[model samples]
Target: MRVLSIIVLLLTTGLTSCWPTSVSFNDTGSLHACLKHFQMDPLENSAPNAPINYPIELTEAIKSGIQNNTRLLLSGENTKPQVTITGKITNYVVSPIALQEGDNAAQNRLTVSATMDIYFDCPNDNYTHEMKVVSTRFADYNSSQDISSIESQLLSEINTQIVQDVINQILSNW
Candidate 1:
């Protein structure tokens, strides 16, 4: 019994020693620590077929996402912000994606595309940097369902994806 106990203790110690002491699930650190304030401009809708309310919804989602994910505060035009974001919805389309027998539509996809420009104001350094990002995301639904009934849900999913993409781009600093 003493021999078995010694073996078990040795094995457990060896296994634990090989494991890391700490782990980080999120590698994307905070956006530049110097940036304390951010300004977001109203996004423009250039897509002819998109709903009138879509631009507003997406803008609000992006704004809230940034505020919730980062430590930066939202600033108005009266105050100069360290960062400014401007974008436009370039495309919105719904089309049949999967076809079944008899040329019937099995599924339809809703695609939304947008373009964004981020301006980093470095007043202390007397220089400014701009980054442009174009992101496209989609969601699919059964063809049997009416698009009007599920449009809001689909947009919500796509909004989350786009928001994540924007956040990743900002943090990547590339």
Candidate 2:
């Protein structure tokens, strides 16, 4: 019995002592950390999903980005970059976390989760991988007027996160 117990402990210790393992194939954080560690850029300014497969929330986010920012190049019939970012919302929700009928604590939680699948069309063709990441945040308002404020800030932040995840995948795998 003592020998068996000792062997079990030894084996368990060995396994636990091993360095942290890689993140899931769908985890974007792992992908980003891996890329940032190497100080490499992972994007080619291409939209991976030409026929974008984002959820309604993501679509709204994209629209908002295009409207407010002049940096995103509009995709046309013959404008494709070397790499593209493809992502979809796996989860999106907004709920009131605390309500006091006033600005005291009436807060809403906004959360969005998405996974990115990056593919290289040129330079290194036939490279593809997927990453999943989630983001959540909170906002407070006393009336519906706050909707615009929250959407402008929280929604955009979440959208940025989703895009960054895709970018991370491209960078890390390269």
Please give the CA lDDT of all the candidate structures: 0.89, 0.46
Best by lDDT: 1
Checking candidate 2 for backbone clashes, the offending pairs are 26-132, 46-84, 48-84, 48-85
lDDT of 1 by residue, 70-143 (tens): 76679876878998999999999999978989989899999999999999887886757789989999999999
Candidate 1: where is the Cα deviation over 4 Å? 1-30
Candidate 2 per-residue lDDT over residues 1-174, each given as its tens digit: 999999999999999899586656443532322121111122222323212333555655543443343223434456554334455545555656666755444566665555545333443344334343333333444445465455656655666765454444444554
lDDT of 2: 0.46
